[model samples]
Target: MKIFPIPCLEDNYAYLIIDESSGEAAVVDPVEPEKVLKVANDNGVSTVKLVLTTHHHWDHARGNEKMKELVPGVRVLGGSFDNVHGCTDRLEHGDKISLGRDVNILALHTPCHTKGHICYFVTGKEEEDPAVFTGDTLFVAGCGKFFEGTAEQMYQSLCMILRPLPKQTRVYCDHEYTEKNLRFALFVEPENEHIKRKLLWAKHQREANQPTVPSSIEEELYINPFMRVDMPEVQKRVGRSSAVEALMELRRMKDNWTR
Candidate 1:
């Protein structure tokens, strides 16, 4: 399986997951249909068989109808609980969908940013390493806002659900917020050398107009403050003792971030 990032409006991203064996592609959050289609064309995709939507947010799911009209007979998928536009198949937790022959996508419920937010975990036969499509629930160095749920839900989604995945699994989130997020991480953990170094790297990547996505679980553990909430140091920094409280405080800080 091959994954290509299609940079969308402002900082958003849409992805093309291609199964090499059959040339069948699964598009994730085709917010900008033309950009996605252009990426698909450039990649020589024979057919687009699936449209995987992570939530019902307009910026994420608004292009579903257009994509469906463009790619006739394509299966538009979204979380079962979400009122997604043009969703033909409503998926549930642990539901597995196969792309082509080897690229298997497992939908995991990761609600917090939205009550129906879901993340897709993808693996292929030929490709030993795996990749996860974390829409807005998890970012390169942060987690999404708790718009529809609480911090406890976000904790479960990020830690218990996404964090336990293979440490080597490449995390593909839906935005270009890594540089800003790392800056916030630095403020939260002033003495964290990992955050300092990652922030510098993110700066260089952005300076070159490059994407700072595909952050691994291992790297997130080291650099992401939200992912490290269970640690004593992170908890203390947030003026919280329990993991859930620490997570809540961290999120509040992120929400109030001005720069």
Candidate 2:
């Protein structure tokens, strides 16, 4: 499986997952149909079999109808929620959707950013390592704001669902918020040299007009503050007893933090 991160409106990202042997592809959270089509054409993939939406946010699911129009018979799959427009197939937790003969996308219902948000875990024949399309639920060094759920929900979503993925599983989140998130991570753990180094690397990547996404779960475990709410240092800094409480405090701080 080949993954292409297509940069869309400002910092948002939409991914294109291609099955190399069959040349069939699936697009995740397409904000713009033309951009996705162009990328598919450039990669010599003419058949787009599926359109997977992570959430109903405009920046993520706006191009669903247009994409369907562009590519006839493309199955639009998303969470089993009312707000997801153009969703022909409603997916739930643990549901596996097959792409071509080898690629399988497992839907994980991680609802914190939205009540019905879901992340796609991709594993297949040609992939060297599995990958997860986290949408806005999980970022490189941060997680999304709890727009529809509480801290407990977010904590469960991050720790129980996402954190347990294989160490090498690549996280393909839907934004370029790494540098800013690392700044917050540094504030949460001032002595963490790993966070400092990652911030510097993200700065250089941005300076070179490159993307700092597709971070591994292993890297996130070391540098992402959201993933460290259960750690002693993080809990102490947040002055919280439980993981959920620490996550709440950290989220509040992040919401009010200035770069």
Q: What digit string (tens of lDDT, one per residue) describes model 1 on residues 1-259? A: 8899989999999999999989999999999998899899899899999999999998899999999899999999999888999999999999999999889999999998988898999999854789999999999889999999999999999999999999989999999999889989999999999989999999999899998988999999999989999999999988999999999999999999987
After superposing candidate 2, which stretches have Cα over 4 Å from the reference? none
Relative to the unseen true structure, what is the C-alpha lDDT of residue 94 in candidate 1, on a scale of 0 to 100? 100
Query: Model 2, poorest ten-residue lDDT window?
Result: 79-88
**Candidate 1 positional error at 50, Å:** 0.4
* lDDT (C-alpha) at residue 4 in model 1: 94
Residue 211 error for model 1, in Å? 0.3
What is the lDDT of every predicted structure here?
A: 0.93, 0.93
The root-mean-square deviation over C-alpha atoms between each candidate and the true structure, in angstroms, is 0.9, 1.0
Residue-by-residue lDDT tens digits, candidate 2, 3-97: 99999999999999998878899999999889998999999895999999999999999999999899999999999852887999999999999
lDDT for predicted candidate 1 compared with the true structure = 0.93
CA deviation > 4 Å runs, candidate 1: none
